[model samples]
Every structure is written in structure tokens, then in C-alpha cells.
Target: MSLSHALLGLLIVEPRSGYELTKAFEADIGRYAWQAGHTSIYPELGKLAEAGLIEVTHEGARGSRTYAATDAGRDELRTWLLRRPQQSKVRNEDVLRMFLISALEPADAITMLRGIAQHTAAGAAELRQIRELNGPATQRGPAGFGLLAAEFGLRQFDAIHGWAQWAIEQLEATADGSQDGAAARSVG
Candidate 1:
């Protein structure tokens, strides 16, 4: 989804300063989905305001301005949410690197795959910690949605870790030059 839509969605809950929105994205929203940096977020807020989607509702110290979604903004956000989802383009550096492992030695590929598994496991653990910290919030309605996303993140990491381990085992078998190695090579 576009940053504008995401920002507008966040503002629907309550008016918040740009700093507050940045923290929300990093602390909650970024955990499971998109992450928009402060630089990007502030600019998007400006654009949303220019489009009459959001407006300054409160001003605080250091030029901080709180923004709330305007009626036009709410309408735009609702329309976008209701529309058919277009094909999403994913850009994962880790996956891209994994795909290029054919250029590396088998041992090196195995090492990389093992690292991927380790990293994924660590990430899953981190998500678990976040979930535990938000226990009460997860039991409620709006907050429960965040918990659901966290659960999905956990599942995704589990799958990635499992696949990495399986790949490592397959490579090890190939290196042994066993009959199964021939089958594995043929399948691959």
C-alpha cells in the first residue's frame, strides 16, 4: 500500500504528530509490513495535506504539528481500501541473494543458507517478545489486528527457517555423491 493510505489509516484512529506516526510505524506497523522512514513520512504527510486528505489539528514544541484525516481523506482511504488489490511487487534482498547462490561453491551456499535460518529464528524470537509485551492489547479489537499481523510474521519466519534447513541438508547430501544426490540434482 502507498504511504499516503497507510498514514491516513493511522490518523483515523487519532490525530498524531509526525514524530508519533514515525514511532507507530517502527514500533508496530513496521514489525509486520511496510516501513516508512521519518524522511519519507514527513514528506508524505505534506503531500496528504496538500491533497486535502489530512490537516494540522494541533501544534506543539519544536514545530511539531499533529495531523488528522479530513473527510476527503477518509473518503479517499475508504475507496482505496475497498478497491481490488493490485499485484504487489516484493523486493526482498535476502531472497534475491539466495536465488544467486548457484554462482557460489556448495559449501559457501550451505553457510549462507544456515545464516538465513539463524537470522529468521532470531527474528521470530523478537516477534514473540513483542507479542508478549502487548498481551493485553492483543486481546482487544483494533489492537488485536496488530497481534494477528505479528502471528503471521511468526509463521512466515518459521517457514523461511524450515526451508533453509531443508536446503542445507539437500546440499550436504549432494556433496556426499550418494544415489539420492543424483535424484536431488535432477529435481533441482
Candidate 2:
């Protein structure tokens, strides 16, 4: 995700100090979309100021400054939003581990599959809470896109959780069949 564009979007919602923006990332935006610590956010803010895409709107105690997006920033953000996104290489570590599950013993693989199911279920529950808090998903307000994003996360979590459960069942069936075969061979 583009930190600059994400910041622009947030500023479009409302003017905010650097500290407020960091809080935004930690609480909302970073949860499902972009993540930026103050180090990266501060530099990007300076660049946005240099480029006239954003301006400092207020100065508070201890040299704290609040910033708002310029008209140009809105235009830029709109253009970026309209552009077609390019396909990029996916690097999901959890998916990679699942692909290599055969490398693990059956018991270890079962444990990992169970862990995935539990984690995804918990993630889905968290997204559901976000969905409730964000309310409706109309495009007419600041909270609109957030509700949509939360819905997307909820769907993803449910799908992964379902897959993990199916995988666990497959592993258990195989284990049971192997045990039956072993018993038969010993008797013969």
C-alpha cells in the first residue's frame, strides 16, 4: 500500500496531527489496509508538504502541527483511486507453510491445521466487531469505505477458516486409514 496515498485519504476525512495520524494507522487503517509508523509517516508528510499536496493547518503545543490535504492532493488521490491496480507477487507466509505441509509429520500437520482454523475464526470475529462499529457501507460518508473493507476482511477470514477445517478432516481420515492398515498387517 502507498503510505502517501493512505495519508491523503485520511486527511481527506479530517485534518489531523502527526500523532493523530499514527493513532489512525494503529487503530483502523493498519488493521486491514496500510501500516505506517511515525518515522515513515513524518517523512511522507514533509514530502506531501513540499509537493503542495498537503499543508499544515494548525500548530499546537510542543511544535505539533496538524495537516490537511490540499485540492491537488484530493485530485491526486482520486486519480490514484481510479487507476487500474497492477498485479503483484503475493508473499503470504501462511499459504507457503500450507503448501509445504507434507514436509511435516502427520501429527504436526494436524496441529498446524487446527491452529489455522482457530486463528482464522478469531480474525473473522474481530472483523465482525469492526463491521458493527463502522455501521452501514454506503459511499456517501467517511465510514463507507471502512465498512466495505471490514466486510472484505470478514469474508477472507471465513474462507480460510473453512479451508483449515476441511484440511484437518482429510488428515484425520488418512491417519485412521493408516492405523487400520497397520493393525491388519500385524494380524496377517
Candidate 3:
């Protein structure tokens, strides 16, 4: 989804300063869904204000402005949410690099795949920790929808981590010449 829609959706939950909004993205959806930084978010908040989609609800110290979604913003977000989204173009750099693994020697490829397995495992652990910390409270409120998305992300990481571990084992077997090209045969 576009950052604008994301901002509007978050504002609908409660009024928040730009810093708080940035933190929400960093700690929540930004981790698994979309990525945005404070620099990007502040400007989008301004645009939303200019378009009458959101309004400043309060001002805090150091010019910190809290914002909430306007009625118009809520309507806009609801409309966008109900419509079918355009198919997203996948752009995962890690997966793309996987496509180039054959260009490396088998030992190097094995190393790279092992690294992926480690990374995926770490991501899954972090998501699990987040769920443990926040799931119960969030699942009981209007925010419960977030639990569903978080579960999906956790599952995705689980699946990827499992596959990565399996691939690493297959590579190790091949390295020891115990599988007689089992990895290649499996792909074919």
C-alpha cells in the first residue's frame, strides 16, 4: 500500500505525533510489510494535512505535532481498503541474489545460503518476540486485525527459514559428495 494510505490508517487508530507514527511503522508494519523513515513520513503527514485527509490534533514540545485522520481521510482510507489492490511487483534483493548463486563456486554458494538461513531464523525469532509481547493486548481490541497480518509474516519467515535450512543441508551433502548431485537432480 502507499505510504499515504498507511498514514491515514494509523491516524484512524489514534492521534500521534510524527515521531510516534514513525515508531509505529518501525516497530510494526514497517518491519515486515512496508518500510518508511521519519524523513519520508513527515512530508507525507504534511501532504495529508494539506489535502484535508488528516489534521493536527495537538502540538507537543519542540513543535511536535500530533495528527488524527479527518472524516475525509477515513472515507478515503476505507475506499482504498475495499478496492482490490494492484498486483505488487516483487523486488526482494535477497531472493534476486539467490538467482545468481550458481555464478559462485559451490562452497561460496553454500556459505551464502547458510547466511540466508541464519538471517531468516533471526527474523522469525524477532517476530515471535514481538507477538509474545504485543499479541494478547492487540488481539482483543480494534487493533486485532494487526494480529492476522503479523501471523502471516511469522509464517512466511518460518517457511523461508525451513527451506533455507533444508537447502543448506542439501548443499553440505553435495559438498561431501554423499548425494551424487542430489541438489541438481531435485531441481530438475
Report, for every candidate in turn, its global Cα lDDT versus the true structure. 0.86, 0.87, 0.83
Please give the ranking of all candidate structures by lDDT, highest first, separated by commas.
2, 1, 3
lDDT of 3 by residue, 108-158 (tens): 888887887788788888778867866563454345647767677778888
**Weakest ten-residue segment in model 3 by summed lDDT:** 136-145
Candidate 1: which pairs clash?
none
Writing each residue's lDDT as its tens digit, candidate 2 over 55-161 gives 99999999999999999999999999999987687888877998899999989999998998899999899989877777777655465757877888889999999
User: Which 10-residue window in model 1 sums to the lowest lDDT?
Assistant: 136-145
Q: Rank the candidates by TM-score, best first.
A: 2, 1, 3
Question: Could you tally the backbone clashes for each prediction?
Answer: 0, 0, 0
**C-alpha RMSD in Å of predicted model 3 compared with the true structure:** 3.5
Inter-residue clash pairs, candidate 2: none
Global local distance difference test of model 2: 0.87
Poorly placed runs, candidate 2 (over 4 Å): 139-145, 178-188
| Backbone clashes, candidate 3 | 0
Best by lDDT: 2
